[model samples]
Structure formats: C-alpha cells, structure tokens
Target chain A: MIEVRNVSYEYIKNSPVLDDISMTFERGKTYAIFGPSGCGKTTLLSLLGALDAPTSGAVLFDGKDIAQIGDENHRKDNVAFIFQNYNLIEYMTAAENVSLTEKIDPLPYLLQVGLTEDEAKRPVLKLSGGQQQRVAIARALASDAPVILADEPTGNLDEDTAAEITKLLCDVAHENNKCVIIVSHSAAVAEAVDQVVRLSHGKLQEEV
Target chain B: MSIFKRAWTYVSRTRKKTASLCAMMCVMLLLSLVGIMLHGVCMDASQNLKEVLGGYVRLTYSASNDREESVLDEALAAQIAALDGVADYSGISTYYLSAPDVQLVAGSFAGQPQGQVPRFVGCDKSALHENFIYNSFEVIEGRHITSADEHCAVVSDVFANLNGFTVGDRFEACLDSVITQDEAMPEEVYSLEIVGIYTIHEGWEITPMTPERDIAENFIFTDMQTADAVLLAEHGVEKPFYRQGVIFTLNDAERLPEIARSMQNMDGIDWENFELVVNDKAYRDSAASLQMLEKLSLLLVIITFSLSGILLALVLTLWIRERRHEIGILMSLGISKVSIWKQFLLETAIIALVAMVVAMTLSVPCSRMLSEKAFDVAETMAQSQAEEVHDPMADVMEKLNPTADAAVDVVQKDDVHLTFAACITIVLCTAGIITISVTLSAVPMFRMKPKEILSDVN
Candidate 1:
C-alpha cells in the first residue's frame, strides 16, 4: 500500500512538474496511472521508487513516510523500477541484466516472464524489444520487493507484445502478491490492470 | 563485490587505455631510473677520487732567492710530523737524467748522449718514505722504490721505452745544480743509474709550456740515497743537503687548512719561503658535479610528475566520461556516491600498479645503458679538451725530456649501484601522480545527480 499527501515536485523553483497531488493505493492490487505527456506520471513513479523525494508533503509506502526510511535503503529493499527503454545493462547477458540486484536466481523469474533458458543466457542487446522488456520485468521480480513501479513499460513493443507484457505485469500483481503500479498513456495497457488512477494537470482522479 | 574484482573488470574492459597508461608509466619510470643511476655513479666517482688522491694539501717548500733562505731540515720535518691530525708523511727528490737518444734499444743505456734537463721533486728518505703514500704512484713495470738504495732508480715506462732502458739497466742522471770553480755558485748536472720503471696511464695528455718545448713523456723514480748522491754529484758539494719540504697526509681533509696555517707559524721555520697549498680544487670540482647531478635529478622528477599528471588527468577524464551511464545505473541501484568514487579510484590504482611493475622491470637495463652513454660522453669531452691543449706533435717532443711537471696518479675506476631508497622515491612519486589524477577525474562524476545522469542518457 502507498499514499501521497499534498505532494509537489519541481526540478527548479517556480517551475512545478507536480503540484499539490494526493493519491492512495491498496496492497496486493495493480494500479495503472493513465496520463498524456507532461502530466507528471513519470515524476510520480520516480517519487514512488524513492529515486527522488517530493519537494513538499510526503509520499508514503505501507503507511510509513518513505522520506524517513532513508532513500537508498528504501529503494534497495522495498521497491523496483522498470523504465520505458528497459534499461538493461548492455554489457551484461540477459540473466545478468535480470539479476541486477544479484539477490536471487533470475532464471526462474525469467521463465515466469516467458523467456527460455537459452534466451536468458544471451546478451540483452541481442534480444528483441519485447524480450528485453520481459528481462527488465524479471529483474524487478528478482529483487523480491513488494512494489514494482513501471514507467511506460510497453512503449516500445507491438500491440501483441504489449498485451503479453501487460498480462505478465497483471499476473505478477495477482499471483505474486505484489503492488504493480504502471504509468502509461496506452488505453489498452490501462484496461489490462486491476484499477486505473487518471492524472491530469498535476491532479489524480480515480476511475471506475 | 571486492574492490579488486571491480578494478579487474573495469581494466579488462578498457584494454587500450590500460596499454596507453602502461606506456606512459614506463617512460616516466625510465627517466627516474636514469636520474637515480647518474646520481649514484657521480657520487661513487667522487668518493673514489677522494680516496685515491689522499688528503687535500700538497705541501712543498718555496724556492730560496738568498743563501740565508732556510730549507726544511730534519728537526723541522720531525716537528711538523709530530703535529696533530697528521695521518701520514712522505718525501721525494727528483733530478734530470742524461741518456742516449736511442730508438728501440733495451737492457742497456748505450747510445749517443743527450743534454742535461731540469727535474723538480721532494726527497723521501731517512724519516719520511715513499711507501707511506705509494698510492700517489702507479707501477706499470718492475716495482716502486721501497728502500734507500744508492744504485736503484724507478723510471717511467714511457721514458724507458723511448730511451731504450729497462729494469736493472744502468743510466746516468744529473742533479739540478752542480758546483763549479766558484764555491758560492752551483751548476746543474750529474750522472746515476736507473733500476725500476713506472708509468702514469690515466690517458689524459699533459699540458705543455710552449708549442716547441714538447710535453715530457720521461719519468724516473729512485730512492732518496740515490737521489741525494746524484744531486751531490751534480752540485759537486761535500756538505749533506737536507730535504726542502715534507708532505703530510692529514687524517681528515677538513683539517688541511687548519694544519697548514699552524705549520706556517711554527718556530724555526721560514714563513716567507714556506707555503702550504690545500689541493682541494679537484674535490671542489667533484662536489660541483655532485651538485649538478642533484639538480638534474630534481628537474627530472619535476618534469616526470608534471607531464604524467596532465596525461593521466586527460585519459582518466575521458574514461570517467565514457562511464557516465554506468555511474547513473550504479547510483540508482543504491550504490553510495563514495562507493562509486572508490570503484573508479580502485580501477586506476590497479592499472597503475601493473604499469609500475612493468616499468620497473624495464628500467634496470635502460638506466645502465643511459649511465654508460653519459660517462662515455664525459670521457670524450675530457679527452678532446686535453688534445686541444697539448698538441700531439708537442707531446712526442716533450716525451723525450720532461721538466717542471706535476704527475697525477689515477686509481679510481667506474662502478655504480642503485639504492633501495631511490626506487621507493620513484614509486611514491608515481602513486602520488595517480592519486591526484584520480581525484580530479572523479570530480565531474561526483557533482552529478543520479536522475540528471539517467535523463541525460535517455
């Protein structure tokens, strides 16, 4: 579970990217943050991942303020992130990329994300875009964190591949007791998750 | 992960950069090695020369213009020898010899006679002897004049060969002054036999007084009795002559001036006709050379560090810039800024260590070669200067007759060794350069925010 109370962020003062935003999500559920470009969706994901702290108010995880948990350890032990470009280390193989934290065997998680053993061993650069995305997902899963924040996770894949990635994310949330929050502009990606939180003009509104 | 593993991974990934760093290190190390070797050789040469040249003072009597002018007597020589700080003392007497101007003749002094020549020296017999300071002479053939033999003489091998004389061969020598009809006036000619031959072979040509006078190749050595007899015969005098001066080798060179000053003021001595000269100019020259070596070594270290710093900085800056994405990823993975900085430093330190080992291995032979070349150049220059001063034609003529000359004995040879302290200094300097370069290169990486780095890459 996570909560945002009157949170605002700006890279520079007088130029706000997120303004007075408030939201909450329950545990063991997938939430899709749907927004057009420049709606602070990625900023919200970064805040949730503890990569950056909100300038005012708080972003809370499991009813405790993340700012109090120490950002580095908080990110290390509690949350994992998947980026739009599937930021796998280019120098490493798929398995190494998936086990970025090196905390567990990434093969089982890669298999759960629909990658063959041979594919997992190959360099991530040699993999298809959808396969690389699955490897990124496997990395997040392998971290054993309860929360996964994916920013535009299916942005580079075809419709069928995007659907498969969306199903994989949903399966991780429902079957693995994870809170999977995906920030996306795609309507199909939003429909695949358990719930949607629409963000526009620095405000969050829940949609049925 | 271990720092060593991280360092190895980075170094393995950047093979080209590692190679370039190694080359630079090798060059720097070679220069430092050359500096160290030169310093060692210069110091060794100085110490060798000092050991061979005895102490600093060259004590001798001043020439008398009047009969009343006093020469050093036995009592005076004894008194001076009793002075404190006197390490050793010796006396020598020299006289010109008339011999046959023969070519390729040996074992006999039979040929056409040459005119009498002038010879200058101090007599070493009775109280003071030559063996006390035998290092001043080099014997190429036969042996040194150890006792006061009335019939024995040690002639230089160069003079003996030119005049066709050998060991045990008899030859006639004349004194500088001979007594004529006038009892008050003395003439300069007498005859004696040669018994031994010595050589001065430092290879440095002796400078001549005139273009036509020819630098003398003739050298003769004899006991004080034979020398005294030859002088008595040349002067035609019945009165015994005492030595003009006593040569003292002091226990320490620093005491030379003090002892000389004290001897100048001793009672029963003629201060006007007696002078003490500390022959420390050679020591001064060697000291100057040592100082120059120190300056050159310091300059070399400065140049090595300055150039290495700039080069390492440029290369490491590019390396750090190339790894910006990795830095961002690591930072985002919750690796602390300090840890990231440490990794980069560890990488450079590993590469530098390998380079230092390789460079040190190569420098030994390279430094030796450089030292040999430098010594050769110095020797060549000394030879050329000697040649310019004493032309070969004049040298040959002087070889027939030597007069009013001071012979130099060369005993020291070339031997140099590198020291542990010097090697340590070189390694420390190299490590310092790397530390500074690493710190400077990491500045940009440390200044960046993780999000900024990631966004820039994206």
Candidate 2:
C-alpha cells in the first residue's frame, strides 16, 4: 500500500501546489489521480517516486515513510515508473532498455508486451510510439516492484493504443496484485480504474 | 547494467560526438607535449652555455691621475678568486719592447731600433692562458709559455714565419723604463726560447678607448717572471716589482655583483678605493634569452591548458545537456546520481586514453622540429638587431672572435635534439592535465540534485 499523509508541496514560499493531501492505495487495485493542469499531480508522483521530498508531512510505502526507506532502495526495489514520453534509452535496444532495470531474460517480458523478437532486438527509437510505450511498460514490469507510478502514460498515444495500455495497467494491478497509481487529466482514464481520486486546486478527494 | 557497460555503449554508439571529443583531447595533449619538450631543450642548452662561458668583474686601480683610485692588484684578485663562487681568473701585465730580428707583421713598423729589425710587445702568461682558454688563440706548433718559464716566448704564427723562427729559437728584446730618455737602458736582452707558436683566432679589445690595447697577433707571450725581470733590469734600481691588474670569472655571471659585495667584506682590502666593474654581457644575454624562451614556453603551456579546459568543458557540458533526458530517465529508474557521474567520467576517460596515444606518437617528432625551429627563431632575432638593439651575450662572443661574422657561426652551432626524459615528461603532464580537466568539469554536475536535473524533462 502507498499512503500520502497530510502532504503539502510548494515551489515558492506561501504558495502551495499540493495542500494537506491524503490518500491510500492498496495492492490488487488501480487508482487514477485526475486533476487540472498545475494541480500538483506530477509533484505528488515525484514525492511517491522518492525523486523529491514533500514540504510537509510524509509519503509512505507499506507503512514505512519513503524518506525512511531510502531513495535508491525504494525506486530500484519497490516502485517502477512509466513516463508519458516512453522514456526509453535512445541508444539501447528494446531488450537492453528493459534489462537496465532488473536482472531478467527480458525477451519473455518483451513478448508478453506483444513485441516481436526482431522489434525487441532493435533500438527503441526504431519502434513506433505505441511500440516504444510497450517497451517502457515491459521495463517497468520486469522490475519486481509491487507499486507502479505512471505520469500520463497514454497522453502521447492514440485511442486504440491508449486502450491497450490501460488494459495492460489494469492487468498489472489486478492479476499481478500490485498497487498502480496513475496521474492524468482524463476523466475516462479515471473511470476505468478501480478507484477515482480528483486533485482539484491543491486538494484531493475521492469521487462518490 | 554495469556502469562500465553503459559508458562503453555511450562511447561506441555515439560516433560523431566521440570523434569530436577525441579530437579536442588530442589537440590539447599535443600542444602540451610540444611545450614541455621546447622548455626542456631550452633549459638544458642554457645550462651548458653558462658552463662554457663565465661571467665576471675586472678590478683595476689607476697609477697616473691623482684623483683616480681603485685599490686592486693581483693579490686582491687572487683573494676574490678564492672566494666561494669564483670559477677561473687571469692576472696580466703588458710591456712594450723593441727587439732586433723579430718580425712586426701587424701594422706599419715605422722607424727607430735599427730601422730594419722588428720589435714586439711582451704579454704575460696570464694573458696567454686567457686567450687560449677561450679558443681565441690556438698553439699550433709546440706548447704554450707556462708561469714557471722565466725566459720563454710564444711567437705569433705570422711573426714566426716571417722571421724564419721556430720552437727553441732564441731572440733578444729590450725594455725601457719611463725615467730613461735617450740613454741606453741596461741590457735586459734575455735570450728567450720560442716555446710555442700560436695563431690568433680572435683578438681581445674589451676596452675600446685605448688604441694600444693587447691584440692577440702582436704580443709575444711570456711568463710574468720574465716580463718582471725585463722591467727590473730596464728600471736600473728605480723600482722593485710592478703590480698588474686583476680580472676574474665566476661560475655564474648573474652573481657577479653579489660576489663582489661579498669580497668587499674581506679583511686587508680597502672598499673605498675599489669599484667592481663586471662585464657579464655574454652571460646575461644567453641567460636572459633562455629565460625568455622558458617563460614563453610556460605561457604557451598555461594558455593551452586553460583553453583545453574551457573547450573540453564546453563540449562535455553540451554533451551532458543533450543527455539530460537520459539522466532524468536513469534517475527515475533509481540509478543514483553517483552512478551516472561515474559512467560519464568513465566515458570521457576512455576517449582520453585514445587521444593520449595519438598525442604521444605525434609529440616525439613534432616537439623536436618545434624546438629546433624555436632556437633558430631566437638566434635570428639576436642576429637581426645590430646597434638599435645590442645583445650583450652576442657582443661578448663577437668581441672574442677575430671577426664579427664568427659570432654568427657560434649562434648557428646551437642544436636541440629531443630526449627520452622530455617524452616521458610530456606524457605524464598530458595525462595529468586531461585528468584534472575531466574531474573539474564534473564537479558542477555532481553538486546538482537529481530532481533539479530531472526538471529539464518537463
């Protein structure tokens, strides 16, 4: 489970981006965080990813504050991130990029992500947008992390690819028994998830 | 994956970037090697020149004018020569004589003294030794007149040939005291053996004001004892022993004044009546020119190092900026800032290794040519300036030579060859500079937080 306890963030003093936000995400569930632009959706993700610290309160993973867990251990052994731009290493082949995260065959994961053996062997840049996104998801899944954090994973994908990615993310949460939290501005994305949370103007609340 | 693998992949996969980086490192290292080689050659040459040519001050006292004073003579010069840093010395007494049967091949013989026979001046052993030591005069036949020889002479080649005189030939010469007017002075016609024959390579005329200065070709060199014997016989109980002026040479000409000052503190020498005159033009010129070359080489090294640092930093910084997305992605994947930095530095180090190899190969021949060319340039600069700019070192050389043209030959004979030590030094220095530049360039990136770097991804 991932928990945000009275967390607040601000780039400048006296001007808060995330204000006393609180939430809990359990395993075997997918949660969509929907918000307007500049509503601190990415900032919350950065906190959960241990890339930054919340100005106040704490973010916890499995009842332990991320600050207490140490940054590298949390990111490397606990959480996996999927970026909207499909942040794959440009020079590395799809298998190599997937292999960067964890010690695995990577070919099996690439095939599971619907990638051909030939496409998986080539550089990530040689793949299409949807194909490259699949490589990023494969890399995330290859890590044995129980929690997955994604920022606008389908924002750069077409409708069909986006639906496919959503289904994959659901499977990762439901079938693999992982807590998957996604930050997006889309209402349809929120409706497809197990739980819907809206971050409106620096405050978070669950939709009825 | 491992840091080494990531670094290797980055280096090999980015061909254009790697090539440009390697090019920058090669240029910097080559320039540094050249600087080291040139500086080493110049320093070595300077040291050898200093040893061959000494620097010194001449001390003399006036006997004619009442106001003129300089409490100096052979004894005092000996004391100074024995002082810590003195290298070599010569004390000379010059006397004019009129000898029958000796050839005067120098200038017009004019009249008097049988009106047919030639008369030559007498030069002491000290004078002969000075000229011989500098190669101004070479004893072509037989040996030189040593100080132990009381009645001996080394005739000049021109005079010896004209008079049909060789070694072991004896001749008569007369010396007149100042008091004697027309009266025939005592017979000091010491039948002096022609101990040696010398050819005057160049003449000594350090003091240009005196028209009758000691010229190498005219003087019949003898021992001081013989000259004094002639002087005493001619004086006829008027004077006992005459004193000669003292000249000294030091191991380092630059310290002439310092040694002179140290000598002033010695006992039995009146500092008020003496003034030390140093002619260190030769030493100073060579020393100064070498110093200039050294400083120039150092400046070149400094500028090259600075420019290399800036250029490398710029190229690598741009490289880092271009790879910001990768950095952010890596950070998001939990690679840690330290790992990223290590990989980056490792990448640069591999490129530097390749460049160092290229630079070392090119540096060997390149520095030799540059060092030789640099020597020629400095020598040419010395030659180009006649009077508007006078190099004391060149002037001293010219004065020692028979003709001024020989001095130019002296300048030309200086050669600079590369050495193993120079190459080794260049390699070490190149490696040090590249390593420092890489480390310093990474400092800024290391201080930045991963979140700060990852912000660029947005």
Candidate 3:
C-alpha cells in the first residue's frame, strides 16, 4: 500500500500546487485519479512515483516513508511509472524498452499487450499511438515493482484501445495482486477502475 | 540489459556518430604519438651528436726554427694528452713528398736541401682523428695503419691505382744527398709496405697535399713512430722525436678553453711555438638545430594536446545534448546518475580505444619513415654543399689540422627508436585527455534530475 498523508507541493515558493492531500492505494485494486488540467494530477503522480519529493508531506510505501528508504530504491523496487507520451525509447525496439523494466524476457509481455512479434522487433518510434500505449502498459506489467503509478495511461489512445489498456492494468492489479493507480482526465479511464477519486483545488474527493 | 550492453547497443545503432568521433580521435592520437616519439629521439640524438662532435681542439707547432720545432716534440705531446679534460688525443708528423719528383726527401731536417722540392705530403697516424671518425676517409681495402703498425702505409685509392700497388706491396723512401754527403749515406732508404687504400668523402676542401695530381695521388698515411724514425736518421739522432701537432678532444665542450689554458700552464709545452685551436663550430651548429627542433616539438605537443582536448570536449558535449531524452528515460528507469554517466563514458571510451590502436600502429612506421626522410634530406644538403667545396684549402694548415676535411658523418647520421617508455606515456596521456573531456562534457547532463530532465516534455 502507498500512503500519501498531509501532502502539499509547490513549484514556486509562494504558490502551492497540492495542498494537504492525503490518499491510500491498496494492493489487489485499481484506482483512478480524475482531474482537469493544472489540477496537480501529474505532480501527485510524480511525487507518488518518487520522481520528485512533495514540498511538505509523507509518502509511505508499506508504512515506511519512501524518502527515508531512498527515492531511487523506492522507485526501483516499489513503484513503476507509465507516462502518457508512451515514453518508450524511440531508438530501441518495443521489446527492448520493456526489457528496461524487468529482467524477464520482454517478448512475452509485449506479445501479451497485443504487439505482434514483428512489431515488437521494430523501433518504438515506428509503432502507432495505440500500440505504443500498449507497450507502455506492458512495461509496467513486466516490472517487479508492486505499485504502478501511471500519469494519463490512455491519454493518447482511442476509446477502444484505451479501454483495452485500462482492462490490462485492472487485470494486472486483480490477478497479479498489485496496486495500480492512474491519474487521467478521461471518463472511460475513471469508469473502468474499481475506485475513482477526483482532484479539485489540491485536494482529493471521492466521486460518487 | 547490462550497462555495457546498453552502451554497445547505442554505439552500434549510432554508426555515423561513432565513426566520425573515432576518426577525430584517431587524428588527435596520431599527432600526439608522433610528437612523443620525436621528443624522445631528439633528446637521444642531441646527446650522441654532442658526444661525437663537441670539445675538439687541435694543438700544432707554429715554429720558426729547428730549435723551436724540437721543443714541440713527442714528450710535450704526451704531457698535453695527460691534461685534465683531454678525453683522447692523436698526433701526426707531416713529411713532404711527391711522385715523378721521386727523389722527394721522405724525411729530412728543415732548411736542408729539398729533394726536387717535394710536393707530395704524408701524415703519420697515432690515434683516430676527428676527420677519420667523421668519415673524411672511407677505407677501401685491407685496413687502416694504426699507431701499432710500424712499417705499414695507407695511400689514396687513386694513388694505389696509379702505381698498380695492391696491399702488401713494398716501397722505398730514399734519403737525400745533403744527409748522404755528411755520413757516407748509410741505410739511405726506408722500406714501407702498402697496407691499405682509402678514398675521401665528398665536400672535402682539405687534403694532406696540394693541388698537383702527383701530390694528391701520392699523399700517404704512415705510423708516427715510423715517421719519427726517418727523421731521426735524417738528423742522425739516436732517438725518435715528434715534429708535428697533437690534437686533443674532451668528452664535452664546457671545459675546452679551460683545458687549453691548463695545457699552456704545463711545463715545457712549447706554448711560444705552439698554440691551441678550438674546433666546436660543428658541435654548436648541431646543438642549435636540436634546440630549435625541441622547441618546435614542445609547441606542437601543446597545440595538438590542447586542441585535441577542446575538440573532443566539443563533440562529446553535442553527443550529451543529443542524448538528453535518453538520460531522462534512463533516470526514470531508476538508474543512478553515476551509472548513467558511466554509460556515456563507456561509449566514448570505446571509440577512444579503437582510435588509439590505429594511431599507435601507424606511429611506429611513420616515425621510422620520418627519420629516413630526414636523413635523405640531410644527404641531399651535404651533396649540394660538396659542389661548393674546392681544393684551394689544401695547404700546410690543412695537413696539420685534420678537422679541415669535410665531416659528412657528423651531419648524415639519422638513428632513432620508438622507445617503450614514450609509447606508454602516449597511451596514458591519450586516455587521460579523453576521460577528462568526457567527464567535463557530462557534468551538465549529470546535474539534471529525472524530474527536470522529463519536465520540459509533455
């Protein structure tokens, strides 16, 4: 479980992006964080993924603060990140990019995510938007980390492909018994997850 | 994937960038290698040149009479040779002679009637003079007459051909009537056997005899003791003595004048009739050139090294800039900044390794070829200078001074080796420069956090 307690963040000293935000992500469940633009959705994900520290807060993985355990170690062993850009290395093949996340054979996971063997062999830059997003989802599934923090996982994919990718993350959490937390602006992504939380004015509220 | 594998994959994928970087490193390393090799060789050559050419001085009798000449004898020659800073010494007693004017007084007193006013000349050899050491004479047959060879003689190749005299042929030196009239002409001839034939190197303005063909052809080298014996017979003296110059050379030229002054202060050296002559011009000329070349090599190393470092840093900065996205992605992979920087170093270092091998392999043969070319140029220069040389210097002074001959060996020798120490230094310096340049270029990239690296992107 990842716990964000009394979290507040700011880029500039005078202006806060996240204010006293607190949340908990449990194992064996998928959660969707919905927010409009500039609502600190990416900033929340960044802090959860250990990309950056919140200005004042405690983000704990298994009741221990992630910062105290070392951000690099926490990110490496606990949290795996998926970006909206499908941030796969353009110079590498899809499978090679998957290999960066896990020591296991990357071809299986890439194939599992609907990339054909030939497509997996081609440079990720040659892949289509939906296929690249699938590769990003497949990479998070392939990693040994228990927590998957994705920022706009299906932000660039069509509804059908986005639903398929959201189902993959849900399956990754339900079957694999991992915590999958996603921040997105799409209603389909929010509806597909087991839990939905809306971000407004640097605070999270349960969406009925 | 492992760090090395990732590094290699990137290197293989970026073929154009790697090839261009390798080419630049190859050129930079090659220049450094050549500069290092030249630095070592120049130092060795300078020392050897100085040893062969420096600290040479000639002492000769400038006598006006028989009494003055007698005082500059064999005993004084030995005393001068024993002085401090005198490394080695050789002496020669000259005798006037000519063929076809065959009644030439082989060995007779001064002011005595000359047998046909002899035009040929002979110099007795005690030790190897600078002239012979510097290839003024090239031995053609048999062996040269040393101090130990009493009755042996070495004539010019032209003289040997003219007389059809091969090695082991005997010749007679006939005494004159002025000495014969006083003593009933006992043992009037001295026997000499031809032991060697030699030719002179080109560019020689000096010879043991004047311009007369007969004299030039008849010039001979004999043992100093043999020449002394003949003079003893002419004067009807019981003991042999020297009537020629003793030239002394030291190991270095720093004390050339000091030794000369010391010899003058020595007892019974006949300083009034004899004076010391310094012959350090050749050594000075060679040292000046070496110093100039050393300065040039220093400048070349500085410019090449600095320029190489700057160029390497520039290209590496571009590579780092190009890989910013990769750096960001790798950081997101939870790789430490240090490990990521290592990957970049590994890539550039791979290029450096290949280029180093190519440069080192070429440096060896190129250094030797450069040395051979330098020697060839020197020989060509000597040849042109030879054309400017003439026989006008063939006079009494030339015969007394062996250095008057053209010393082709002093300028023609070109020997160099690519030493192991210098090669090792080149390798180390090349590696150090590359590593430093890579590290310097990576600093800005390494400073960025993963957040910052990926922040500007969507």
Deviating ranges (above 4 Å) for candidate 3: A206-208, B62-85, B96-127, B140-143, B161-196, B203-218, B236-242, B253-270, B361-417
Off by over 4 Å in 1: A1-3, A24-27, A60-69, A98-100, A103-132, A173-177, B35-55, B65-90, B94-200, B203-270, B281-294, B380-418
- Please give, for residues B1-458, the per-residue lDDT of candidate 2 as tens digits: 88998999889988898998899889888887777767777776666555545555666554442322433444566677789888766655555566655656444333444332332333334342445645567899988766577778887897788788999988876653322345665544567888889897666543433222133455677776776665566544233222445567778756777888887778876555555566555545555656788789988878887787677777777777678778778877988777877888788889988997898788778977777677666655544432334434553323453221232334335554546776666556645655555556555654554466667665
* Cα lDDT of model 3 by residue, B1-458, tens digit: 87887888888887898999999999988887777766666666567666666557777656553553355556666777887778877676665432332332233322335423333223445235544555556678888777677777877776677567789987766565533454465645667788888775632332333233224334577777667776776665555545556667787765776877787788765556766777765555455555566566667777888888788788888878777878887877787777777888888889888998899888878767765565455445544544344345465444433331232245335455567887677677767766776677777766765777788654
Order of quality (lDDT): 3, 2, 1
Each model's RMSD to truth, in Å? 6.9, 7.1, 4.9
lDDT by candidate, in order shown: 0.64, 0.72, 0.72
Q: How high is the TM-score of chain A in each model?
A: 0.93, 0.95, 0.96
Per-model TM against the reference: 0.73, 0.69, 0.85
Q: Write the per-residue lDDT of candidate 1 for residues A1-208, one digit (tens) a residue.
A: 7788899998789677788888887667999998888888988988887777788979888889988887777777778888887777676678877665655788898998788999998878899988898888788878777888998888877888789888888888888888899998888988898899988877888899
Across A11-44, the per-residue lDDT of candidate 2 in tens digits comes to 9998899999888889999989988888888888
Residue pairs in clash, model 2? B282-B393
- Clash count, candidate 1: 20
Here, model 3's chain A TM-score works out at 0.96
